[model samples]
Target chain A: MTHTVLVTGVSRHIGARVAGVLAADPDIDRVIGVDTVPPSSLTRGGGGVALGRMEFVRVDLRSPDIAQVIAAADIDTVVHMSLVSAPSKSAGRTYMKEHNVIGTMQLLAACQRSATVRKVVVRSTTAVYGSSSHDPAVFTEDAEPIEVANSGYAKDATEVEAYVRGFARRRPDVSVSALRFANFMGPGVDSPLTRYFAQPVLPTVLGFDPRLQFVHEDDGVEVLRRFAVEDHPGIFNVAGDGVMLLSQCVRRSGRPTVPVPSTAFRVIGDLARGVGRVDFSPEQIALMSYGRAVDSARLVEELDWRPKLTTAAAFDDFLQSRGLFGGMPLTVIDWLATVWGGGMKR
Target chain B: MKHTDTSHDFGEQEPGTAQVIPITAARRRSAGGAGKADVEDRLADLLAFLRRRVAGEYEVDEFGFDPELNDKVLLELIRPLYRHWFRVETLGLENVPDEAGALVVANHSGTVPVDALMLQVALHDDHPAHRPLRLLGADLVYQLPVLGHLSRKSGHTLACPEDADRLMRKGELVGVFPEGFKGVGKPFAERYKLQRFGRGGFVASAIRAQVPIIPCSIVGAEEIYPKIGNLRSIARLFGLPYVPITPLFPWLGPLGLLPLPSKWMIQFGEPVRTDEFDPEEADDPMLVFNLTDQVRELVQQQLNRLRLQRGHAFPPFF
Candidate 1:
């Protein structure tokens, strides 16, 4: 069915790409992109994303006018991707929390009030699972968060998901699909993890090596586009196959790691944040200590789709985009290791 | 032997000795050359392994099981302790399936849970297929700093039904200690006595996955630390199951942390088929409880028989 789609958070790369992709679709009748600012001003990667056949709407989603837009445009699909994962320097934690939680609440409320909205795709995060020692190795959709997110974007995502679930209940006609994405990584995406890797040296929790997964920004946009035009329902985890050890990632990026005690890691993180070098929140700290991985079987089974790039391949792409070089050539390192390890064997 | 004795007794055997010298010398020279060639071949293999690791061309399963790391490094590190320190002897390894998934239910002991490590090494080294055992560790194992990281890298995961079910469904060998901290921290007097299994979660997981339960009994781990006393205050402060006061622990301080060199034996019983029951029976408490009790009894009987055969924890070398 040809339908009108309202895509929020269009200023960012993922949002812009999703909006553009949806607009380019022959099936989608109209794609309305909304954000507080236009796509170019806050866009990171030069030239920004092309809006294509889509129309841009500059307005705060929490404002009552969002409901008016949904009702007036007769939007059939609401794609909510505005939830911020990191606390930006320009915005405080409180603002980010409010923007994520309240903005989601307002958008879902608008969707709930509008009879035209048939499908709601909320871009959720795996952070809702909460990284803790008590967590299962892989979290399925129905798994409870062993460590409840008490603060930061993790908590905000939890509240946002809860609101989306409540909206689904109220508007039984609306098919809600929450895509709990792993850390997004790609050449065009600028996430906290990218910033963390952009640094020359990485400070990590001593004696702890976390396993991390990522979703390429291209995959993120494609997944968003799929949900926007499709009828898949229920929460799904979207991540590339396999996981990379934090140390392995650092090695692959050719960055030196300074292993700090778990307690001192917080101090160093705070110092880095205060210097405006990298954004480090408590949840991110917990993440770096004990990483999170989610099972994307549901997504694959229901949507008949899979990520194009594996975690390692996506990481390599990110490294290349950032111009980071490996420390020693694999051939040389292997030769040295063989000579050394072989000599020891003798 | 007769020639050597005669040569030692008579000085006239010098000429006969001279005739044997060149043959022995030639043999030694060729043996030395072969040793060098063998070393070079091994070095080449090491190079290839290092290359794969450097390029990140290795696979780690969803449960964070680094099979490459476990097979190459972690197991190697534990080998010396298993071969020399514990002198582990394993039996009934043939009972383990060659390829298909099986749940190994073993008794947990050794204040430090060294028994689990020994059991893992036994399965990997002794089993004909050389299957890698994915052990299910308690949350405490994953909560520690170095220990947790190493455990995960070595192919161990948190003791949860989801991980167990996932591992078994993937046709991977999974090991679990139903006793948990209770069996490990019990007093020295209660060493061989089996503790209550936790809620039959492992049984349900095996049933759901349709994997056989391999009852494993480990003897000699009980005497490794000999948990004679517990420092309750210290244990509470550190959030440990127990602060064991072995004879030499607190007295010798850091040196006492070394595990006692006791002979170890691990025996895997015949597979307890879970496929006979319906998968829905996993949710039935009565069936789950009965199966759990039956597995527990099997492990207990094996433990008693093995302990009887072992005679004593530390046997004197003749």
Candidate 2:
């Protein structure tokens, strides 16, 4: 049993949900959520329905002081969820990297030295397998890194996994599980990919319809809970089954798409980023261009865990939550009917 | 591990979560309020399926095989060509395994891959079991935009040892054109001449899966739009494999693009069981080469036999 749980990056939605779920677990004596900054939102009632005995820790993982927090808490299972997918408005690229790379390193170092730490769950992404012309159609868990990752969250996560491996090697007794998730989509997830889709106009590469896979925001938190509680001892790829093409996804969201040239996407993305409209990071652009997908056979066959939603189902759930053609939108349609009839009368 | 109260409480999802009604479902629900003819109803059904597919909700299997789109759009569109123009006839169809998975090693030909498409339609429509042949395609097939999505939705995957092995393991009948671009772009004179077959990769995949290899020989496809020449520079500029300069294509324009009605013959030869050899023997180059040579010779012999039996370059359909 986990006497005390130290969850990193609790400011983020996924981290907060995991912390909330763990705190609610009666078997867990204490749940501490660590974050340098504050959370973005808390109004999510259904999707963010996690509440329990979660304590807060305001410590930066880049600093050496994080070790004191882990050692002091007597944390047995350390769930590191603090890695930022993309930096917020106040922070720059350097801050995001520090929070991801440095935060993960400090947390791992603290875990390595601590005698009480027995379980470690690190949230990673499949972006480490960069998209390219040479990528296999379906990526398995042990798929090699085909292209060199120069910079971005992809590199940060790659470096984070390497350090976690190094730490695991040093302390064989500790159970380290790295979960590499695909793109996240749901009303509550609010990832850059989801944001790109939510835009009124979706820009896609002219001659590419890369396949995309997404995990529901709820499933994302649930998987973290499973890893933290269960003793899964290896790297696993997490994503809902099935894939959707880029063009297909664009149409599904009820958005008109502007087909831009492959090279021009970066310029448009940078412009969008500069104006605070969207964070079209290189990883996300590559994703929108070629798209990425991972096989989760091992997650099911080995870990004995299954997600409730398929990729299509997850996107459907997101669409429903977004209130497209549902809820009050129907009333607006009703108004349109009355106005059109009145105009005809005139 | 200590179990907790969190299991029953949070495990059950909060009620009244929203569900996105597929556009087709939404449209049909509204369309049903107004009555229509049977033909209109069928058209509405097809349109609804296409709309839902475009807006997503088309289900893909474990290997990214989209069956609904395959049946509704892609295969439905190809039915006319398979049945009417370039009508294809299968000989010794029983040589194909009726139930289990088998690797179909067919000769690739014609300026375009109408032969492969015809073979797929033949297997799908005329075969005893009507099994869909999952054709292993090149990287180009998956990289192209609109074509790529259609190909994947129609159950064509990248031709690789990993995929071939996986499909056969799943008992899915897979089709392969081992001759590849060589046979597809070969000149009219080299019509029936087989290519190198790419180092026997498909043979090894069959051996790994311990399935049978069915040697498939196709005739009458080469005569359709016979490639007399190729514009190398122009094709290179467009990033295509090669632009076939057919006798009528560049001169007559789109009219020349239409294939002449040819009586095509698809002959499936007896199966060569890979189970006889050690599954580990897939690594042995000599055995693989000998087996590949044997199959190639068998296909060559069968091709000649079918040609002799047909007795005409453009045999009339019976």
Candidate 3:
């Protein structure tokens, strides 16, 4: 059966890539890419192909116009990828929460009313697990967050996932897939985590080095496209296997780090954000303090697919794109070792 | 007459003894050459290790077990304490499986949980296969900042059933102390008396993973910091189970934190097979209780017998 898919948040990197990939697929007849603003070359980060075949719809999910856009083409699949993690210059926390929470509610409401929509794929976040000391080493999809994210993008994603669950309950016939993606890291992706890593000196929480996982941008888009085109319903964790400690990530990027006490971490984040160095929200700060890793076994078992890169490999790709090496060159280290060894032997 | 007879015997043997000196010198010369090469090889190995650590080029398992770091650094740091300070004597290491996964249920003691570290050192250094013991620590261990990170780097994880089951499924030797803070903080008079085993979570995990349970009894940990009294108010303020009032502690201050030099002995008891029971039986409270009691009893019995054999707290000879 041919699919007429409606993809939200086409203005962003992952959303645009997913729309482009889905539009190129022969199995999908028409891909409707909708966002409040038109997709520009600047936001695409230079690698995505032109999204020529997809139709662009200027519809803010918070408004009632999204329902009309969904109903116009007899769209059978709705892929909601519009959730914003960090506040842009024009938008603040209030608007971001509005776009993420109310926008998702409106989109689901529209999908619920539309008789033709048979599949809904929502791009959620592993932040819903809420990094904390009480968390399991690796979270399965079914594990509830030990400390619920009280604020920020994690809270927004948690609310978005709940709305998706409600939508699934209401529309029993429609297949719903909520992809709880780990932090997206790769070339051509501009995420809060990527911005944090781009800094010259990383300030980390003292005494804490949380385990981190990443899903490469290409894998992220591919997973989104597959879920949009397939019938694998229910929630699934999408992440590259393996985990890297945050300190290890910083060291691998060849950047110096300043250890800040936990109480002072927020102030440091605020100071960094004030200079436009990186977008460090409270949830992101907590994530750096107590890192989160999700088990992607369900993705492999049910979907018969795994990410192409491991967590470390994906981080290395991100580092390569930014022209950062892990540390001092190996040759220099070998030379130093030889000199030191000779001196010690004497 | 006797002196002359002894002189004649020595005189007859002197030339033959002198003939062996050249062969001994040749052997020594080759050994000296190898020793020089060995130093260079060790230096290269140390340099590689430092490079890996600095470049973050090592791998940790899903549960954050860095085998390379654990073997090279963490265990090495504890080896001196295990060998000299505690003078650890390992027994029945043959009871631990050679290859397959096994759960080692040991009694918790030593106010600082140094016993756990010593037990790990013993298994790694003494076992024929030199297996690494993956310890399951309490949440408190992971709640501390530096300690938590180091613990994970050294192949330890939260003392939860999920971690236990996962470690065992991976054919790891998982160590657990079901008594938890109770056994660790008990008074000096109650040293050898086994505290109540926790809600049988370890046994359930062992059954679910179908791994044998090896009862390990570690003596001499209790004497390390003998708790003569408990400062409950101070413990509450610090969020600790107990503020131990040892004879030296709080009286001598920083210097008193040193653990007493007690002779240590770790005895691994017979394996309690869990494969006989179905995995579904893990949910049966009665079976779990019975198995937990059985393991606890085995550990306690061995503790008594080992304590008897250990004799004095600090022995002059083995």
Candidate 4:
């Protein structure tokens, strides 16, 4: 078991939660949360997630200085959670890529030079299995990854996993796990897919109702924490069991679906991207049109881990936590969640 | 200005438009009670289904097999084609065990996969137990977008060893078309000739599952959409195996997609027990090939017998 842990990307919700959880654990002696920018409201040691007994360090993973921080902490466990789910408006394309791919490369290189690091857990997404006409119904762990298109988060993650594999090959003594999580949905973390669903009139491909899968942000953090503490090595898919159709999800979320023809969808996507309203990247469009599924038998059968919420429940959770990050106050959203959820139950 | 009394301009030819209230006891009772119970009952059933769907109560297998949808909705649509249009007569339903894992290896035909759907209907409707058949579909069935989810909801999975072994181990009836596209898309002149079964995969799956291989031979499907010619280039453009040039297709457009109302006969031969050999023998190519040949011969012989029994392509009755 690792005593001191280094968690990268603490500025992100999942990363902060992970660092907080590890710091609160009595067994762990120290928790070092690192990021280029200090999180806005994560008051030094404790806040929403109770960052107990933790220390925040401002270190950019893209620089060679990240190694000095790792060496100073004498960290035995490294949890890399800085991989951005989607490119943000404020963050330019170059900044996002530099933060993800270049940052991951530099961070892995730092870990390689570190003498004490024993276990490394990476936060990867299921998008590595790109959606296409040729995709199997449900991809098992043994299947090869689909060819990702250029300039998408999936492409970056694919390259990230390749680098992780190389790291594992070099350091046979250390254990490395790449957790491929489904779409993240929860109270605080608002992913782009959730934003797309939150639209009043959801757009769908003309004749496609693909099965969509989602994992709660809480479940993602728990899986990451488990890998940080435990010795489960190798790649594993993290997702709930059941899937909901995209139309079904939109309907359940109380939104009407607008069927966009092929050419119209592309045009609308380009327009949306031009003004930075939202991204309808080709990979995301392909996924929305022909939903992808992964067989995570290895998660439970081999690693002995299971997610708490199913896909439908995760969507419900997202709805319940609506308005949390989109300029809506937490107290108001909590009260709304109570009233709305209660009425729906009746 | 020609301003006249607009209300009386028609000279009382038209009756005044007003709301008619049901003031009498009989009228109100008829409006409130008559036929309301029947409508209410149907509404309640629909509401229950919707509630089940919302509450996620319907059971789906690991492979996304929705028994509720398959039994209640999808199979009902196929019943008409099975009963009246095709007038399908099925034999040796007794050979299929009432409850057990069994592999029904059938010949693929009909240019399209109408035969597979009909076979599924036969196993469900004609059998004493009314068991659903878990059809192992080809890549084409799942390669298309909406068709993939529909196929899964209709209780079919991709024809792979993982899914096959899982279904059989769960004691479900599995149906496989070993001839695949080769048997289904062949030219009409070569109709009813059993194509070469691919590499004996079904036999291997059966052997691994330790289930009996029930040879199901389907007749009259070839005549439904007689493939006079094939356009490979056009088919490749649309990502299909081949553009089957049926007599009515391409010339008739969308209206021609429908299959002909040909007479049909389905016969299930005796079970070739995989238990006769060791389960590990699934790994042996020779043993798998022998069983594959045996199943093919069984289905081909039955196909010939059924064709002779009907004596015509479009028999008046089965």
Runs in model 2 deviating more than 4 A are: A40-51, A325-346, B1-44, B47-51, B62-64, B315-318
- Candidate 4 chain B weakest lDDT stretch, 10 residues: B17-26
* Candidate order (DockQ): 1, 3, 2, 4
lDDT of 3 at A314: 94
Give the interface RMSD of each candidate. 3.6, 5.8, 2.7, 7.8
| Candidate 3 local lDDT, residue B10 | 100
Pick by DockQ: 1 or 2, better one: 1
lDDT by residue for model 3 (A42-107), tens = 355454556758899888889989989888899999999999988776677899999999999999
Supply candidate 3's per-residue lDDT for A258.
Answer: 88
**Worst lDDT window (10 residues) for model 2 chain A?**
A325-334
Each candidate: chain B TM-score: 0.87, 0.83, 0.88, 0.85
For model 3 the local lDDT of residue A62 reads 94
- Best prediction by TM-score: 3
Fraction of native Cα-Cα interface contacts (under 8 Å, chains A and B) also present in model 2: 0.34
- Rank by TM-score (best first): 3, 1, 2, 4
- Per-residue lDDT of model 2, residues A314-341, tens digit only: 8877877876422233344445546643
3 or 4, greater by lDDT = 3
Candidate 4 per-residue lDDT over residues A245-288, each given as its tens digit: 77566645655569897568889988877777567888878887
Kindly report which residue stretches of model 4 are placed more than 4 angstroms away from their true locations once superposed: A43-48, A146-151, A303-305, A323-346, B1-40, B50-64, B97-100, B169-171, B231-239, B245-258, B275-281
Question: If both were scored by lDDT, which would come out higher, candidate 2 or candidate 4?
Answer: 4
The TM-score each candidate achieves on chain A is 0.94, 0.90, 0.94, 0.89
Task: Give TM per candidate.
Answer: 0.91, 0.86, 0.92, 0.84
**Candidate 2 docking class:** acceptable
Candidate 3 segments whose C-alpha is farther than 4 A from its true place: A42-49, A328-332, A338-346, B1-32
